[model samples]
Target: MGQEFQGGVGQVAEGDINNYGININLPDKPEFRGLVTAQRKELHELRAKCEELGDDPRDVWRRVHAQLGVCSISEITAEQFHEARTVISGRLEQLQEEADKRRLMGKILRSTAEKDARQEMLNFCDLSFGRTQLSHLKRNELQRVLEFVQQVEINPQPAAEIPQVQTAEPLQLREFLLMYKTNAAGLFLFGIFVGRFWS
Candidate 1:
C-alpha cells in the first residue's frame, strides 16, 4: 500500500496523504519568531513616530540602516534594535523642535512687519533660498529674512516721489505767449493798411 525508498541506512517509508514522509510545514523556533515579531513592532513604532512628526518613514529607515550597518530592518539584530529606535526618536524630536522654532519666527515676522515688508521678505527668501514659504526656510534663512523685514520696517522708503515737471511747464507757457503776441501784431498791421486804403 506504501512505496519504499532506499536510504543510506535502510529503506524509508513513504506514507499516504494521511501521514507524510516528512512534515515540511513545521513552525519556526520560538526565539526566531519572537525576534521577528519584536522587529516588526519596533518598525511599526518608528513609522508611527515619523507620521506624528510629519517626516518620511523612508528617511527614518535609511537612518536606521546607516546606524545599524544593515541593509534592511529585518537584518537589524535584536541587540541593535534599541539603538535604531533611539536614533529615530532623537531625529523626530529634533525635527519637532525645528518646526516649533520656525513657527515662532513666523509669528514674530507677522507681528512686527507690515504687509509690504512681509512681501519683500518673501521675495528675498524666494531669490536667496529658492523657497517662498516661511515654513520651508531653514533656521538661518528665516533669521536672515526676519532681519530684512525688521530693517524694512525701521527705514521704509517713501510711498512715491513725484518728479519735477515744473521746468517743462514754464517752457510751454512762454511758447504760448510768444505765438499770441505774433498773431495779435499781424492782425493790427492788416487793419491799419485796410483803413488807409479805404480812406
Candidate 2:
C-alpha cells in the first residue's frame, strides 16, 4: 500500500515521527507533493551515500546542486514522448537492477511521478488546470495545451513603467490663443453676415 496518514497525504503521524525522527517540511500543496516527496527521498539517499563515503557536507550539497542542474527532457510530440517513455523505462530498470532490492518502492514512486507528469501535460494540452486526463485533447486543442507547456517564459510588465496620467503633455499657451482667435474671427464674420438679416 502507498503511504497514508490520518490527516491526509504528506501528513506525518505522531508515531511515525517518534519512530523515525523524520521532521522534514512536508509540502502542503497536494498536487505538487508527489514530485517534492520524490525529490526529498532522492536527497536523503544521496546524503546517506555521503555519510558512507566520508564526503564533506558542503561538497555533498554542491554535488546535489550539480545533479539538479541536469535539465528535464524537452517537451516532445505525443509520438516522440511515447518512444522516450519506452527508452526511459528500460534505462530506469537497468539502473534499478544495479541498486538494492528496492524494486517495489521504485515502482510506486515511478507510478506516482508518471501520473503527476501526465496530469501536468494534460493541463497544458487542455489550456486548463482543472481538466481531467480522460477528457478529449486533439489537434483543435493545441493552442490550449501550449499555454501551460513552458516552451518560453514571459516577463511581466513593470508597474513603474505605466504612465500615471494618460494626458501627460502640458497644453501650450500659444496653441490655445491661436484656437481662441480662430473661433472669435469665425463668430465676428457670422455676426456681420447674419446681423443685417435679423435687423
User: Which candidate achieves the best TM-score against the true structure?
Assistant: 1
Clashes of 2: 2
For candidate 2, the TM-score is 0.18
Instruction: State the lDDT of candidate 1 residue by residue for 156-179, as single tens digits.
Output: 676788876765444475576687
Model 2: residues with Cα > 4 Å off, grouped in runs: 1-152, 156-178
By summed lDDT, which 10 consecutive residues of candidate 1 come out lowest? 4-13
> How would you encode candidate 2's per-residue C-alpha lDDT over 1-199 as one tens digit per residue?
3534444344534433432656567555543212344444544465555445444545554443344442232222333333433443343444444342343334433543544454555445355544444233332343344433334333445666655767657658777567698876887899999999999
Once fitted onto the true fold, the runs of candidate 1 whose alpha carbons sit more than 4 angstroms away are: 1-39, 114-199
Tell me each candidate's TM-score: 0.40, 0.18
